[model samples]
Target: MKLISQPGPKTDFSMLLLFTIVVLTMPIWLAPIGAGYPDLVQKFAIYGLFATGFNILFGLTGYLSFGHAAFLGVGSYTAVWSFKLLGMNPVPAVLLAIVTSAIFALLIGYISLRRTGIYFSILTLAFAQMCYQLAYSVLTPITNGETGLRVLQSDPRILDGVITSQTEDGGPLITNFFGIDMTKTWETNIFGIDVQLNAGFYFCAFFLILGSYIAMRIFRSPFGMMLRGVKTNQNRMNYTGVNTRPYTLAAFVISGAYAGLAGALLCVTDPLAGAERMFWTASGEVVLMVILGGAGTLMGPMLGAGIIKYFENILSAFNKSTLEGMLGFLPENMLDGTISVLSLFVGEGWHLTLGLLFMVVVIFLPGGLVEGAKSILLKLTGGGSKKSASAQAAE
Candidate 1:
């Protein structure tokens, strides 16, 4: 297969700039939607990074892995341990998490990449489940079992002890960047709306931007072209005396590192690590995020992550009382009937709504939201004619 042409530096800069603006301004734009809260926005950044990393493997190389959550969990555990044994400086925790996760990914990818297709997917799922079980039961000493891992006052924080004073009241230490507490927020009134610009959210957003730039560079690199070739026809490349295994393995490792960074960010904000993060469901959720946002595209995964998180945080907050207030103008009987049906799709039933949305996207917009959006833009701008002209000329 021929190598894909790389995008120009100017194009890359413009795209990166636009992406940065969009992410940094999320609080301002999302305030009206009732999703401007710091915690939820932090989740948006963390999971967006997770899905973006997963896309490097699944999107580029067509490798469907079900064990990425294992790496994420590992990153979190490592970061928390860094806090317990080392210090609360997020820089070292993040760096150590990435390195440790990369190593884990290397070992896992080495074995898992031996198989292809369904077998590979099954192997990943099995490995992730094994990790979850170990963290939950077998590795109780390290993971703290179901109780999860957290920084404790009793733990020996050698680095913190050397540089900082002990807490006067002996409370658990909070994670921070150079003594800038992550949990602190700057709140203001924006056009009658309460907007909170959080330190932790900005911290995650910085990494998200960095990760996106790295992913973009990889996507436009020779290595990325090789990965796309592996996805298109591994056997053909093999026939040409090329070893595709290393390429796929490298992609897997890089993707794992991205996941690791995300997990570390999670701990940086919350300072806790749990086996639940390694569950198969978490892996599956990232897959959905990548697909829903449009795999193989730069902005798709982040968009998907935002949508899913919004639904999780906002839609799932609805209750019978909330619905009654929203529909109070209707007749009592009709309102009750409406609540009965709608209630089944919101709150605890939000998954049903997500599933329905997934089905609609898969059946009608196979390219996901990205494709749906492109189609709409093409129609509005009469861009279809330009695309047709190019195709006809090529033919």
Candidate 2:
């Protein structure tokens, strides 16, 4: 393994400017894509955080964890409990979730780091599975069993002066920061394009930007250099008197905290945390996102996350009628056959599409969509460097 790839010297503020532009204009771009709704938009930010954080460990240090979702679930449960017992304000909930998940990651990572390669992966998977089972059964009092944990009407929010489960609109109590309601949205129809922008999404986007900045700083730091050293050759680092375990453990904890933060954000957006969030498949999904987007690259995970969320929310909603409208130019029998074939990839069968895409990425674009795009651009310009291509491929 080549560890994290340094693509080249970056121009000052170029990345920052790009990230800012993308974050600021998502509502406009997503509107045309039929995913301008608040919930799906928030998901893009939350999962972007999760995948970016996972990349810090897996991409930089080559540690493939199959138990990161355990931290995400822990974060969710902690946030909900904070709301139920402390207050509806999300600041304390987010802080508590990060600290709690960090401690959990420290313990789990310490033990799991005793092994490397496949053994390490299995250890993380086992820990996550144990957490899932515990939450589902033994920890029912804490996790609320399979029904999951949610803010209840009768709970006391000690920090806030007034605590009511029902708002004036008679809807369920929503999360807020101070007096700014997280669920409040401004809906607009411009030229027949419906757009819904919510405060919750902006909140999540702020954190996502913060998280991306932190990840970028880490990637450029000397500490990040040490991590790549550990990934490339741990035994050689050990021989050179460098302690690799601490570095790996710290990365694991940081990644876990990131996962926890993502979970808390999920709760902040919807205020529901289910035991199912801790499943191994949830962890696998993050892994897929990292690999599919070009792991080790800053924007790759975010791109991968956006692709998955778009498919999950938008593509999966396409029914036969929607397909017919898109394929209206076809004859009746031909349209029906096309819809039947396409239906296997859209709607409830979106997972099949996801799987096929995953296979294509693995086979043809091993460095993922970003690297493939880079290769294409390099070819078009007739200035391709083999060394740069290899570095991009390694990522």
Candidate 3:
């Protein structure tokens, strides 16, 4: 028997350096891109982590679980409960979120992994819908129904010994890291552009980088190779006496832990947990993020998350006036006609635009944005080296 040692830190310096630069300079680059707002920035980090985790199972193991959001919702519910009954600091809340979500994932994974293919996907989806229905109805006692669970001013924090959630100024106390309030934001004008940097965004960014690093390690590990084998040919692995179910289940639980952490971060940012977060559509959004950004690639999830969120937040916010200002250089008649047609794809019709974009990516760039970009770059550089390089890298 041979033991496989985990790779050393030095093996991943490039990955660490890349993410470090990106995370630290977000306030600089993200502002120009219309996603620098603290709230949106936090979403990018949270959903990026969520998609990255999902890729671990779906990308590597080829086992798509639509119930992953169930774990995320469970994490949010647990975190809020921790804050409500335990303490105001986010540490315990986040820890409890991970633990509870992991347990939930374990149970769901156990049942769903009993089958494969579309059957597996259906089982996961059914489990997620059941969880959502229960949370919205039967579990309303704990989940707080459709109104969502939130931090209240009168709840007792038995662990922290603080009786009320009010400050001397009479506003409700916000979630914090020790003494630093997670909601605190630092605003400044940089090169004539406004940048809103929040403590909570940085906190989420830290976890995103940490999660990405962990994922990169997994991608380069023997366990990840086995999972890939399961994806590529599970029958061959089974013929060789490999218990692929355990491998897939481990991947599923690991991904759920990541989703749980992401969910906890969401609550840490806003101190609220809604049953809507567990809906199957939320799971589908992460799936689209993973697919749009390049599932198997390390940076794909982040890119996909940013792009999808950009469309959802920034593009959807554009009104007729904003559109007119941007296209004012055109003839008034032409502009009116263009806006009339474009109006259906922005704002209230943003889903149409999103659907179009998804279709474009799926049809023309099946490997997602990363692979498409790689192909374009390779073409500019000239030749067959791109295919050979990608094939070699995959191997």
Candidate 4:
């Protein structure tokens, strides 16, 4: 038995520092791009965590599970239930959500791991769809069916015996850490830009940093190597007396725990749970995020999540009038034509733009955005490297 050493300290520190800086400064940098709003930023952190988790299983083990949304939904439901029965504090809610979702993932992974390839994918998708239907119909009592489950003042909240569940005018209770409200936002002007420092966004960002660090550790560990072996050739490993199922299952559970944490953050920012979170499309979207960014790479999933969410929230808000305003400098006839053609790629047609982008990435940069950036960098430095090598050889 041999020990697996940690990732090189310099590499881990630099990567973690860069990631932390990028995430923490998002509000300042993203303001010009119209994505600095608290709500949107919160979503970026949450989904980034989700995609990073999914990358663990799909990227390392080569086992794609489409039913991760079931774990997500379970986490959400568990968090809301915790708030309803326990207190308005997010700590208990988040802890319970991760535990419950991990257990759910364990059960699902145990069964799905029996097969491989597309059969495994289909099985996971089937399980997710079944969970969706159950939440939407049969499990209505717990999930609140189509209406969704939400925290209410009438709920027991035993942990907060004397704390008021309503505002001065009687509004619903809000989730908080200690006395700090999760929905609280401090608005300030920085360098002539409107910057919002949100409590909830920072909270989610904290978890995102933690999740990324843990994921990095896993990627550098011996267990991660075993999972990679499973991806490379499970049959060969099996023949060599290596039992790969346990490694694959562990990765699945860890990934599910990450999804659960993201789901809990969702409810922490907004105390509600819905069946829609468990939909097949939700699972599919995370898959797209991982693929669009770069599977098997740490920061790729987060980048993909940010791009997709930016399109969904900012680009999708563009209307005919909005387009006309931006293109007002053009001639009357030209402006109208431009708006007409561009209309299909913005606002309601944002998905069309996403599809085209996905197609281009798949065709040109099969390794996603990370690979594209790397290729560009190589081109920029390739000539200088060649010249230096020739000079050294002549000497």
**Ranking of models by lDDT:** 1, 4, 2, 3
Q: Count the backbone clashes (under 3 Å) in each candidate.
A: 0, 0, 0, 0
lDDT of 3 by residue, 102-181 (tens): 88898999999999999999999999999999999899999999999987767775665453343545587688777778
Per-residue error for 368 in candidate 4, Å, reads: 0.9
Cα-based RMSD of candidate 4: 4.8
lDDT of 3 at 182: 91
TM-score for each predicted model, relative to the true structure: 0.93, 0.92, 0.92, 0.93
lDDT accuracy of residue 333 in candidate 4: 77
Pairs that collide, model 3: none
Evaluated with lDDT, which candidate comes out highest? 1
Residue 373 local lDDT, model 4: 81
Clashing pairs in 1: none
Instruction: Give the range of the ten consecutive residues with the poorest summed lDDT in model 1.
Output: 1-10
How high a TM-score does candidate 4 get? 0.93
Per-residue C-alpha lDDT of model 1 across residues 1-395, encoded as one tens digit per residue: 11234569999999999999988988878898889889999999999999999999999999999999999999999999999888877888999999999999999999999999999999999999999999999999999999999998878877874655446477768876777778889999888888899999999999999999999989988889889889999999899777999999999999999999999999987899999999999999999999998998888999999999989999999999989988999997798889999999999999999999999988887887996797678768977777667657778
Which candidate leads in TM-score?
1
Q: All candidates' lDDT scores?
A: 0.91, 0.89, 0.87, 0.90
Error of 2 at 93 (Å): 0.7
